[model samples]
Each structure stands twice: as structure tokens, then as C-alpha cells.
Target: MSGAETEPGVLVLAATPIGRVADAPPRLAEELADADVVAAEDTRRLKRLTGELGVEVTGRVVSYFEGNEQRRTPALLGSLLAGERVLLVTDAGMPSVSDPGYRLVAAAVEAGVPVTAVPGPSAVLTALAVSGLPVDRFCFEGFLPRKAGERARRLAELASERRTMVFFEAPHRTEAALEAMAQAWGGERPAAVCRELTKTHEEVRRGPLAELVAWAADGVRGEVTLVVQGADDVPAVSTDDSSLRAAVAEREDRGMTRKEAIAEVAVLAGVPKREVYDLVHKSGPGEATP
Candidate 1:
């Protein structure tokens, strides 16, 4: 309890190397050596990392992983409340993104402990930079659902998502995820699959979802991040009653009943079902509003 006094408790979330240790930021070593407690996703990995960095950690070290996050966060926060600097580190990348640091961060923030980040190597941005997709407006979708049906349903929900999307996935499931994407977002939509980013064997494959599905069938290895193009803007439709009638009629031509066709068209067009019905039933042909 006598490490220091009158200093605010700071919770530092440090980002470690995703692959090559050489990529570690110099401040990471300084923080590890000086921190009062080092909470790591894997204590063994932390030990190895400290050995590589040649930093002597004088403070206590504890494991904070998925299995024990709920139990460990409070203990770490307790240390913070005692005016100790608790540094959080993961096996790779930043501490929180798809990692174990988020819960602790949330707790620390709620407890009024100052939270900061030692930003360093990041697989999300690394993959997105090399993905050659639109990065200006993109969303990070950490990981897709593991089950086949759930995964497909999740992708379907994003069918009309306008921003570029990013995802992290297991090597073995890459093909299946890409196949589902192709079926949901059209086979020709552009996408990129980045593998082993920032490592020696880093690979970036870019093309349509269908091509990626076929390519991944041969097998992929290492960590994977996927970036996908957004939906192209559709041609503007007349707000008149005729356009709605035509939309419904087109759906009915494909064997759907009037009600079923309206529902399907509304989904496909990303509009309300009630709006489609009103447009077809209320407004006549060319006089509809735009």
C-alpha cells in the first residue's frame, strides 16, 4: 500500500504486438516496468513479452482472461482505487477489441478511475488499410456468429448496410462466412480478406465475395479480417402508385401472392411494408409523389 501517494489511479490499456514483437511500442516496456500491477490476458505470454522487452516488472502480475474477467475486473479496480497504476495487456492487438479489456475499462470508467490507452499495433486498422476497400466510412463488426444459420441471418440483416463492414473470423470458417456473404450481398460485391497482418507471411486477397469463397475453399491459415463493400445506390423510384404496383406485380410474377410480393419487395428495397401496400393500393399510376 506504500508504492506511492497523492497520485490519481490510472488504468492504462496497452496494445501489444499482434504478431512480431519488434512492432511493440517503446512505451509499453516503460509502462510494464513501472506499473503497480500488470493484468494480462495470458500471464505466460506476458512473461515472454517482458523477457523479450527486457523490462523488469516490479509490481504484481495477474491473469485476466475471458474465463476470469468477471472475477478479475473488480480486483483490478480495487487496486486502482488504492492509487496503483494497473496496466492491461492482451496476447495481441489492443486490450479491448475482441479481447478481455473492455469489461475492466467499463468498470474503471464507471468507478471514476482515469482510463487511457497506449495505442500500438491493431489488426482491425491493419486489415482495413490493406483491404483496398472504402475506409472513409466503415464499421468494425468484430466477429460474425459462429453457427451457420445464425451467421447467415446476421449477414442478411446487413444486406442493405450502407457503410463498409469489417469482420474477424477463424481460419476454418472463412470459406463459410464468405459463402454466406456472397449469397446475401450478391456474388459480385467487392471484398477483401486479409490474413496474418503485420506478420512475415501477411497476405491480402481482394475480389468479389464469390471469388473469395472459391479461393478460401483451398484452406486459409492465421488470423483473418474481412472487409466488404457497401450496397450501391439504387436508381430513384417514382413515388407514384404505379411504381408500387409494378414492384408488387414483379414479385407476383415470381410466384408470390400480392401480400407476399409486397412483403418481399419491401424487404428487398429496404422500405416499410405498410408504405409499399399504401403506395400500391392508394395512389394510381404516374401521379405518385417522388
Candidate 2:
């Protein structure tokens, strides 16, 4: 076997700046200049970024995006097996983060090729840092479903997620997304809507989810990153008959129907719906039932 064939290749996952060109790291430029092959989500955008940085890519360039990732994986793997240093980059942020590059990484791992990263700017971290919310423990939820029902169902599934959550959203859908979040996680949930982060016209709007919904209704522009506070760890109330009645009464006061109140109270109390229903009925007007 030739020397190149005997040697294992390296896969470098390079992170590009989300907005500001200056955020691109020195190592990123070095990788782009020296790699045997550069697989980018958008070769045009990659060219533009390199121009802005005044760096010349000496390596062969190829497209590696969602549309062509599957067909391109094997060829990229072939390069790696041939001991070619393959560099991966996406249009923005880190690769494999709501972007392509994951499949290539998986393939490289399986083939026993060495893999490393040249971490740089990230929309997720940039938004979280500027959001002013608790970031000590957080989760990155890339993007919500495009359809209304699917989106709502996804939000509902995360209604009780206790970790601070971050999400990327298109400018056009910001208003609808905020509105849905308000409905699922309660209107009063604290959140921040970061727009055009790290670039000119960057704006970070922080407030209750309901207020943000109204703000977005007026319309918003630019890429958006949403940071939401986790569910409050409310102490579990007693599940006794009196507690169930109180819970039901609270929901009723909030405009819920009696049937709706009973169902919600059962969920909160971790009891059967029938038990809550019987308790609500047994407690007659002004009748104290413990």
C-alpha cells in the first residue's frame, strides 16, 4: 500500500460565523487554506466569506448540504479513506447544528477516520449569551415544525421541559411561533427574542411571552433566536379532596369550563379525572368537604 493509503485521514468540522465576518477564527482560515477537500453547505457563501476574510482556499471545494448530503457522503468518505484531510462547513453557525454535516461525521466515525472541530461563532450560543436568561443549563431546540398542528403538538410535548430552551426561527414565522409558545407555556413565561445577532441592527427583546407575541404581531425581520425560561418548579400541592376543589376553582376563575377544570386538576394532582369530578360535585355551594 502507498503511504497515503496506509495513513488514516482527518475530518475537520469548522464553524463559520453566523453573521459577523470578523467572528471567523484564525484556525478556520487555516483549515480552509490547507485541507485537501472542503465540503460546504453553500459553496457560494463559503467563497464570499473567504473573500471577506482575505483568505484563499487552496483546497478543492464541493457542496455538502441537506439536498445532496446522502449522495455526497460516500465520495467524501472515499477522500477520507485516501488520507485526504476533509473540512466541513455550513452556511452559518456550527455544522451538524440544524444544518448538514452530521451524516458525514457519522460516516467518518464508522470508518475509523480521525475527527476534530474548529469551533467558532454559533447562533445558539450568541443568542443565549445576549438573551439575559439563565444559561447555566439550557437545551438547543433547532427549529419548530412548519405546520400549525405539528408545531403545537411539539410545543405541548415540551410544555413542562425544565431546562432553558433555545430555538432558531425564520423571520416570517416569528409572530406565529411566539403566539404558539404563549399558548403552550403560558402567556407569562419569560423569554427573549434575539434578532440579527452579532451584526448591524442586532436586537434582543426580552419580556413575557404574551408581550413578545404582540410585539411580533407588528412584524419582525431578520434571523431570530428564541430563548425561553424553563418551567417553574412549583411545589406539588396536596392531592386531597380539598386541594382538588381548590385547583378546580382556580382554573374556573381563569375562565375554564367545569369539565376542563376537572381534567386539568386531575393532571396537576396526579389523580384520576373521575376522582376530581366526584370531589367537585360533592363540595356543594358553601359546603366544606375535607
Candidate 3:
């Protein structure tokens, strides 16, 4: 192997401030000013952040967002292989949580490149900390499905998740998303909706899911992160024929072929695939699915 290949450059995943500019770590400026290349989700946002930090990025800056992450991974990997320090920063929070950099990071690791991070602020952790929910054991579920049926199914799959859950949602969809959560998890479930965290107009609404849904009905704005209470008691995995059939039907309704839906439903519910197929067809009278 060539020396450059063996001594591949470092990939620094820097966490930019999710809200307040002061939340950016001191090393973030140093790394931004020193790296050979800086890949940003939004170059304009990076420029604003750098200005706020009173630091200038001396490296080459390139756009690296969802649209071009796949197309650009190889080029960034080349820079890493060529022994250049490449720093990656997203618009807010860490990269790859629900952003770009996963592909590049994975490629760099495959090429034996050194990968490091400048951990700072995170919306997931920030919301969780102030959520007043159980933080001892929690899970980041990212964003939920946008479509209603798909969203309901996704929530169903996580119905038994015992760990506190965190989810990101768009400002416009906040009300609808909360309404779905109320329907799936019950109206009384406790949750918190953190909006524009750490910013001047930041607000954290804590209450029952039902109440949140009602409050959001008027409309919500800014970036949103929800912290929800997990099931206090893990419910029994539904094995009833009616429950199983309904589960299969939902997936099929979402465009999955019947066979595909059965298999998926079986795996998701931990039931035998054959059973789902059989019971789904064993309707007595008006139980036909159409």
C-alpha cells in the first residue's frame, strides 16, 4: 500500500450549535480554521456560524447535504486517503443523526482513515435533558413516517419500546404528529415538545400527549424535538388472529404485496410468517379484506 493510503487523513465530525452560537465548543473554531477541507451541509449556514464564532475557515469549503451525500462521498474519501484533514459540520447538531456524513464516514473507515469527533451540542440530548422524562434509559427514534398509516404502523412497531423516546418533527407537522402519537400511545401519555431550543424564543411544552396535540392544533413553529414517556409496562405481544390480521392489512394497504406484508408483519410481531398468512385468509364472514 502507498504511504498516503496507510497514513490517510482524519475525518473530524464537528457538532455545530443546534441553537445558541455560544454552545459551539472552543475546539470547533480551531478545527474549522485548521482543517484542509471543510464539508458543510449548508455553506451559507457555516459562514454564519463561523462569523458568530469569530473564526474563519481557511480550508476549501464544499456543499455536502442529503442531495449530494452519495455523489460526493467518494471525492471526500479521496481527500482523506490523500492525507488531508477533512472536517464535517451540519446545519445544526451532529452529522448522520438525521443528516449527511454517514456515507463519507463509512467510506473513510473502510479505507482505514482516522475518524474523530468534536462533540458539542445535540438536539436529542438537549430535549431529553429538559424533557422531565426518564433519561436513564432512552432511545433516539429520529423522525417518524410522514404518512398517516405508515406513521401509525411505525408507532405500533414501537408500542412496546420501554425506553424513553426522542423524535424530531417539522414545525408545520408538529400538531398532526402529536395527534398521531396521542392516538397510538393513548392521550394520557406524558411528553414534551421542545421548539427552537436555546434560541431567544425557545419554548418547551410539557404535558399529556393529548394536551400537546390540542395545543399544537393552533400551529407550531421552529425546529421541534419530542421526548415521550415509554410504556411503563411492556404490553404482551399481540398474537390474536384479529390483531395479527389487522397488522398485515395495514402493511398491505401501504403498497406492500400481500406476501411481503405477511412476512414483515410476522417479523415485526414476532409471530410465525405462516400464521399471519393463514389467519389473514381465515376470515369467517364479513372479515374479508378488500
Candidate 4:
């Protein structure tokens, strides 16, 4: 009885539904009702969830989102130390997966507060489940960098990633992201775009990168998750400048014009125009222009 009287030092990081309220884990309602304090990414969303669960949040409620996590974590930690069972939840999915709650979790660990999760629906896994890709090994690359240059550099680095890659992007940026991926990962790479998983308008568009880019150009709305095929150990195509130029020069020898040859070789070798040109130029004056 004395042990039972002792305050709970556990920090609960609960997973919320990504969509469809009915999909929420059953344990969530009981946890919310039993917690001494609840830290939510959005209090209004929490309220809505509680309403749906028909569970009253007798605990004190506070906001703990990206904007206030740093400031809020310490306060929540203080509550835990005081023997309060402080629960952290995001608007959807697991907190800290491209969402808030990372700071609070770190703070709790430092403060020696025990932390556990009430695992629930996840957009990443949901998308991957329907992706039909090689998920035996996979990596989640949460939301790509927003800037075009940084995003391209990131994608270029991931070009050789051997595991399936999952990413989340806003509806508006879906097309641009797909296009950039096509440029970096080859247009033929297989991918899937999952939107509004488990919701009424749930959609999964699976195809080559080039086709996905074209599909996205028509505009996609709602939460978006992308699963891209990883680099297979297939032998690299000969796209070195000289190699491409040789192929292009061969095309030229066959009556194809310089512009036509460059474009054709660039497509065949799966490389950029500038890359093919450099190959041709480095071949030296006389050696170039077959």
C-alpha cells in the first residue's frame, strides 16, 4: 500500500492517430484519464481526442509543441519529479518523429524519470506497409529540407542509400520533391505516394519516379508520405563524360546532330547534359566532335 501511495515517476509518450479517430489505441483513453498531467502538441486536438474517447482528462493539460518544447520540457520534468505521471502526446503519430516531444523525452531521461510508450498508429509504417517496396530493411528520412539547394544535396547523398527510404512532405511541395527525387535518384526508380492513410480519401500512387512526378504535378492534397526504392547493387551505367561523349559521337557518326547526340546519350547513360558535355570537352580538341 505504501508503494502504491508513492508517486509515479514515469513519462508516457503516447502515439496518437495519424488519421481516423477510431484507429487510436484503446489504452490511450485510460492513460489520458489516469495521468497527473498531459503535455500535448496541441491542446485543442487533445480535447477533441478526449471527446471522442469519452474520457475525461482530470489531469492538468499544457501545450508542448515545436514552438514551446524547450521552455515546456523543464516544467513537465518538474511535475514528474514531484511524482506526477506526465504524459506527452503529439497531434498525430509518435511524438518526435518529425513532431514534438523529443526535448521532453531527453529532459526526462536526464532527470531520471522512467519513460515508456503506448505505441499506436504511425504514418511512416502505414505508408511503408502499402508501399510494396523492399521493407525488410528501411530508413525513415522525415521531411526533406525545404530549401531547394539543401534538399538536392541531401537527395544526392542518399542516392547510394541501400535501404528503402520513407519521407513526409506537405501536399503543396509534393510535386517539387518528386521532381527533385527523379533528377537525383533516376526517373526509373520505383516509389509510392501515400496520402491521408486510413482516412476517407486515402490514396496510394505507386510507380516510377518520373510518373509520380507527373502525377503530383496535377496537385495532391492531404498528408503525404513517400516511399522510395533504395539503391540496388546493379552495375553502374557508363556515364563518365568521355564514355557518354563516345556514345554520343557514335550517334553523331550515325547521322545524329550534336544536340541530338548529347540528349540521346544523356538519356541512355542516365546522367546530366553538363556531365556528358564535360566528357566530350575533356577528350581534347581533335578527339571531340566525331
TM-score of every model? 0.81, 0.81, 0.87, 0.79
- The Cα error of candidate 3 at residue 139, in Å, is 1.5
Worst 10 residues of 3 by lDDT: 248-257
Question: Per-residue CA lDDT of candidate 3, range 1-290, in tens?
Answer: 64532578899999999889989999999999999999999999999999989998889999999999999999999999888999999999999889998999899988889999999999999999999999999999999999987787777666657899999999998998898888877899999999999999999999999999989989998999999999887533378888888876765554456676677678767888888878978867776443
Off by over 4 Å in 2: 1-5, 234-290
Per-residue lDDT of candidate 1, residues 1-290 (tens digit): 66545555999999999989999999999999999999999999999999999999999999999999999888899999888999999999999899998898899999889999899999889888888888889888989999876676567556657888999999999999999889777899999999998889989999999999999999999999999988876344444556766877754543345676667567666678899887767755563222
Write one digit per residue (lDDT tens) for candidate 4, span 1-290: 34554554789989999999999899999899999999998999999999988999999999998888898877888889888898889999998899998888888888778999999999999999999999899999999989887787677656657899999999999999999999877899999999999999999999999999999999999999999999886344486555666776765554445666666667657888777776776677677542
**RMSD of every prediction:** 6.3, 6.5, 3.4, 8.8
Candidate 4: where is the Cα deviation over 4 Å?
1-8, 234-290
Worst 10 residues of 2 by lDDT: 249-258
CA lDDT of each prediction against the hidden true structure: 0.85, 0.88, 0.88, 0.86
Clashing pairs in 2: none
lDDT of 3 at 215: 95
Which is better, 2 or 4, measured by lDDT?
2
- 150, model 2: CA deviation in Å? 0.7
**For residue 99, what is the lDDT in candidate 3?**
90
lDDT of 4: 0.86
